[model samples]
Target: MADMSALTEAEAANRLMRLAKLIAHHNARYHAEDAPEISDAEYDALVRENSALEAAFPHLVRADSPNRQVGASVETSPLAKVAHEKRMMSLDNAFDDAEVEEFVARVRRYLALPADAPVAMTAEDKIDGLSLSIRYENRVLKQAATRGDGQVGEDVTANVRHIADIPQSLRDDAPDLFEVRGEVYMAKADFVALNARLMVAGQALAESKNEAFDPETVRQFANPRNAAAGSLRQKDAAVTASRPLRFLAHGWGAHSALPADTQMGVMQAIGRWGFPLSEHLRRFENAAELLAHYRGIEALRADMPYDIDGVVYKVDRLDWQERLGFVAKAPRWAIAHKFPAERAQTDLVAIDIQVGRTGKLTPVGRLTPVTVGGVVVSNVTLHNADEIARLGVRPGDRVVVQRAGDVIPQVVENLTREEPRNAFVFPDHCPACGSEAVREEGEVDVRCTGGLICPAQRFERLRHFVSRGALDIEGLGEKTIQEFLDLGWIDEPADIFRLSQHRDELVGRKGWQEKSVDGLLESIRAKTSPDAARLLFGLGIRHVGAVTARDLLKRHTTLPALRALAEDIIALRAATEPLPDEPPHRFQARIDKAIADHIGVENVGAAVGHALADFFHEPHNVQAWEDLLNEVSPPDYKVDVRESAVSGQTIVFTGKLETMSRDEAKAQAEALGAKAAGSVSAKTDLIVAGPGAGSKLKKAAELGIRVIDEAEWAEIVRGG
Candidate 1:
C-alpha cells in the first residue's frame, strides 16, 4: 500500500475518485454479471486502500465511494426489480485476530458493557454465494430477490422455488411476514459437474454444426460462487430447475413478530421452520471462543461441500444489536473475519506477452495446474515487465502462486530465482503484427506503436469504440465485434459504418437473423451524425480522454478545424528552435507554453497537443481519419447555453462540491452559459470555491478574481 501521508489533498482526492470508479466497475462485474476479473483479495486490498485514504483525508471521500455502496445496480437485469423492504446490507471485514478482538470490544463498548462482560455472538461460515432474500407471507412463500444495490434487487421468486433447500412454506408457528435472508449456493461437486456438462454440450453443438470445437468459446464459471449466482438468477425458472443449487439461512428481515430474544435462538427457530441452517453455526460467549470457531471452520473449508471465504460473527443479543445499529453500508454489531488467500507451489511453464487495446504489452505466466484453495490455477498475471524483473521470474522456474482473495491467481515469489540460468528477454516487437514496441520514458509499460494495424489492438479498439462511453451502438458487443472482425467485414472505425453493405450476408449467417442484422445496421447508421467529442474520443488517441476531447471540440467547433489547428501547431513546433544561451529545460518550457496558448483551452495542455499532432503526423492515421469522416459526418460541437448571470464568463470550480460531483458542477456551469476552466488564471472571471480549495483558491485571491462559496454558487445557479 502507498503511504497516505505522502499524498497531497488534491492527489488524494483524485485517487479516491479513480478508486471509486474502479471499485464500481468490479462491483458491476461481480454482482451484476457474475463475472469477476480480479480476486477477492485484490478487491479487498483496493477497498482497504480507499478506506485508509478516506480515513486520513475524510473530506476527500467521494460521493461514489465504495464504502458508501453495498452491491451493484440491477437496472439492466431482465428480471423485474423488487424494492427491498429492508436494505440487504454487507458486513465489515476483519483479516486478523486483533481486528476480530477489536470488533467484539467495539460492540461491548457501544453497548456500554464492562470489559469483562460477556457479549455472546453467533459465528458461522460466510458462504461465497449470491445473497438472497425470500419473503414469506402467512407461512407461504411470497417473493424472492437477489441483493442488488442494497435497496433494490432482481425478482427471482420463480427461480428459488426450484432450489429444494429453500422451503416454499414455513412452519405454522413462523412469523407471518418474515424475510429469510441467506445464500443460494452451488456445491463444489455440482459446480464442477455443471461446467463439464456445459463444455460437452458446447463441443456437441460445434460437432453438429460441422465446426471444430474451440474450448475458449465454451462459457464456464470462474468459481462456484459465480456458478451459483449465474444459475440462480436465470430469467427462465426452467433453467434454474435444471441446475443443482442449495440455500442456507443466516438471518431474517421485515419480521412481523420476534421469534427469539437472541441471534442463535432466532436462527434455531428459522431452522425449525424448514430452512437449511449452517451445521457449523454456533454461539460463543466471547471473542476468544469466536476466534477458535473461526479457525475450526477454516480447517474444514477444503472438505466442505461449498465455498466459504470467511466467517461472520454477529452479536447474539437482539436488543443489544438494535442499540449497536448500522453504519454506512454494514452493521456495527457484526464483522466478517476473512481468510487470507491460499497459496501453492507451481512450475512456471512459460511467459506470454498479451497486448491490450491500448497497445500495452502485459506478461502472463503459464503455470502447471495446481489447486491453491480448491480452484485450479494455471495462469497468473505478471503485471508488466517491471514486475517480472522485480520477481526475477523466467520460464522453467518454480514459483509460489497464491489465489489472492481466491479469485485471480498471481505469482508472489520465484522460489528458483537464485537457481536461474538465464534471465528471460522481454520482447521489443508486437507479437500480433511484428510492429516496433518501445517503452516510453517514465512509463513502466512497453507499447506497440502499430496502433490500429496490430490485430489485438484493432479488435479491442473496435470493442471500446462501441462501449457505453464511446459511440455506444446498440447490438455491437464484444462477441459480435470479434465475429465481424474475423469475417473481414470490419477493420477500422470507418468499416463499422460500411457494415450495412453486408446486410444480406449477415442475415444468412447462423445467429444473425434479418431483424437483428437490420437493427445493428440501423444503429450504425444512427451514428452518421455522431457527437463530435465522442467521435474524437472513439479514435483512441493518446493523452486525449473524453473530457479533453470535449474541451478541444468546444474550442475548435468542428473536426476539420481541430485537425487544422493540430497541423498548425505541428508546423509551429517544427519551425521553433532554441537559442544558444537558453537552457534545454527553459526551451522545453517555452515550447510547452506556446503549445498550451495555441490550443487556448484549460486542462488540454502540451501533452494532448503533441498527441494530436503525432496522431495526424502518421499517414496511416490521417488516411483512417479521412476515411471515417467520409463514412460519417459529425456535426459541429455545441453546448445548449442558457442566459444567466455567469453567461460568457470563464469560471473555475475548486475543491469539494458537497452536494454535487465536480463533473456535475462543471455541467451546471455549462448549462448556465459559463465556461468552466480547470485552473484559476488571469483569464478566469470567477472562482467557485468549496472546502479544501488549496492552491487554486490562493491563486484566485492572488489574481483578484471574485470567489464565492459553493452555497453562493448554488444560489447563482438557482437564479440562472
Candidate 2:
C-alpha cells in the first residue's frame, strides 16, 4: 500500500466521493447498457482506486456506496405497477476474494456464531442484466412484471411471455400464487444472432451509452440490457417476439404455495416445474465451501454464456432470510461477491463483414484461437460501425479481449505495435452471396440485396422457413439442413418434399442408416401437405415471411392462383415505385400494402408489405413456387382466423418462447384464425408476450394497449 502521509482527510474524502461517482457511472453503463467503452482492466483499476480511497477514509464512505452494491435501481419505463409482496432488495457487493472472505467473516460476526460457523451459501453467477418477476396461479402463469424501485413497476406481461426459461403454465405443486424472480438477459450467442439478423435486414444497432446509441445507428438498440429491458416492456407481443432474449431464475419474492422452507428448495422445485434453471448454481454447507465455490466459478467465469458481474450469496433457510430482511436498499440476509474483471491478449487475424438473413451488416474479428477458460475463442462479434471506430482495431492487430464470468469474449483494446491500415471497410456486397448491398437511410449496417441466395442467408432463411415460426417442420433441423445441403440431397426448400422419393439415398449417406432415414422421410412427408401459410413461408421469398405468407395465403390459398397473380402483382409494384413509372424494388412497402389490401388483412402493415411485394415481384420467385407446388401437396386449407379482443392480431415470437416454442405458438395462433404478425404494431389485438420479450413490449404498453398475462390469454383463446 502506498504511504498516505501527505494526503489530508479532506482530500482523501473528496477523492473517495469522486471515485464512487465515476465507478457508479461505469457500472450504470455496463449493467444497464451492456456496452462498455473502457477496457475491463481500466474498469478494474477504477474499482481498485475507489476501494483504496474508501479504505483510507472509511468514515467518508456512504453506506450505500457503489463499491458495496449488487445492482443499480431497476429501470421503470416498461414494467407494470405491482407492490412486491416482499421487497426485492438489492445485495451488498465485494470486489475480490479478500473482500468475499471479509463478507463471510462479517456475516459470522453479525449472527454471533463460532469462528467456523457452519453457515451455508449458494453461489450463482450474478447475471449482468435486468431483473424480472413472473407470477403463476395454481401452477399456471398469471402475470409477469419487473422490479421497479422495489414496488410499482410498468407491467410487461407480454414481454415476459416470450422467454422460454419461464414456464407459461407451471406444472408445480408449490403455491396458489408464485412470483419467481430472475435476470432477463440476452445470451451471448443469441445476442450475436440477433445482431446478425438486424444487420442482414439493414436494421439499426441498439443504443450503447444512451447518449451514444442514437437512432442514426442502423437499428438503434440500447445495449443488451436496454434492449432486453425495452423488449420486456412491449405491449404488442409481436414486437417483443423480435428480440433474442432469455430468462434465468435466480431468486423469488412471493410463493405462498411452496411447502419448501428454503430458497434452494424453491429453485429446485421450480426447476422440476420445467423452468430453465442455471446449471452452474450450487448449494454449499459451509462458508469456506461457499468461498471455494465462488473461487471456482470466478476461475471459470470467462466461459459462461451470459454476463455475470458477481456471485450472489443468500441465507438458504427461508425463515432465516425473512428474519434478516431489508436494510435500506439492500437485504441484510444476502451479499454479492463481485469478481475482478479479467482480461487476455490475443492476435487479431482478420476483420470480416457478415451479412445476416435480414440484410443487416456486421463486423466480426477473426482471432487466433485461445482458451479463455475451457471454451475455445476464435472470434469475437464487433457490434457496429461506431464500435469499430472506437476500438481503432484492424486486421493483423494484437488486441485485448475481456470476458467477465462466463460471458462472450469482447475486444477491449487494440494494441498492435505496427501501424496498420487506418480503417476496415464495411462490405457493400453480401460476402456469402454477391448481391449489391446497401445501407438504408439513417442506418449503419450495409445489407445484402440477395435475400435467399447467400449461403448464410440461405441457411438463415431455411432455418426460419422450417422454424417453429414458419412451416414447423420436425426432424429437419439446422444440422440436418446443413448435412442435406452438403450431400446435395436438397437444394431449394422444394427439395424437402422430394427427399421422400430419395429415402434410399438418404439412408445410404455417411452418418445415416435405414432407421434414421425413414424417420427423416416420415417427418418431411408429414409436412409435405403443410398449410398454405407454411408453403408461402417455406418458399423463401424476400419480405414475405411467416406472417406475410399467412396473410397472403388467407387471400389466395392455392399455389396456382398465387403464381398466376405474380405478373399483375409485379405491375402493381411498378406503379408504386418512388421513381417515375418504374417498378418498386421487389421489397417495397406500398406494393406489400397493395397486396395486403387486394388480398385482405388490411392489418398487414409497412414492413410485411415491403417484404411480400419484394418476394412476389422477383422474376425467379414465380418459377420457384411452381416448382415447389408441383413437388409437394399443400396442407388442407383452413382459414381459422379468430376475431378476438385483438382479432386479426399479427404476432411474432422471437427467442425461446414459453408455454410452447415460437413455431408451435405461431402455428397455434394461425390455427385459431388469428393472423400471426412478425413485428409489433398499434393495430395488434394482443401480444402473447413470453419470456425474453424485449423492446416490443415497451412500445406496446407505451401505446396504451391492453396486455394480458399468458394464463388469461390462454383462457381467452380457449373461449373461456
* RMSD vs true structure, all candidates: 8.7, 21.0
Put down candidate 2 lDDT per residue, 561-637, tens digits, no spaces: 66555655556766764756655343343444465455444324333444455566666665666677776788645
lDDT of 1: 0.85
Number of clashes in every candidate structure?
A: 1, 78
lDDT of 1 by residue, 393-476 (tens): 989999988765435577778899999389988999999899999997435679999998899999998988887667989999
Clashes of 2: 78
TM-score of each: 0.69, 0.44
* TM-score leader: 1
Top candidate by lDDT: 1
lDDT of model 2 at position 214: 33
Whole-model Cα lDDT of every candidate shown, in order: 0.85, 0.66
TM-score of 2: 0.44
Worst 10 residues of 2 by lDDT: 203-212
Q: What stretches of model 1 exceed 4 Å from their correct place?
A: 7-22, 73-81, 106-120, 189-223, 255-262, 317-328, 404-406, 432-454, 468-471, 479-517, 525-720
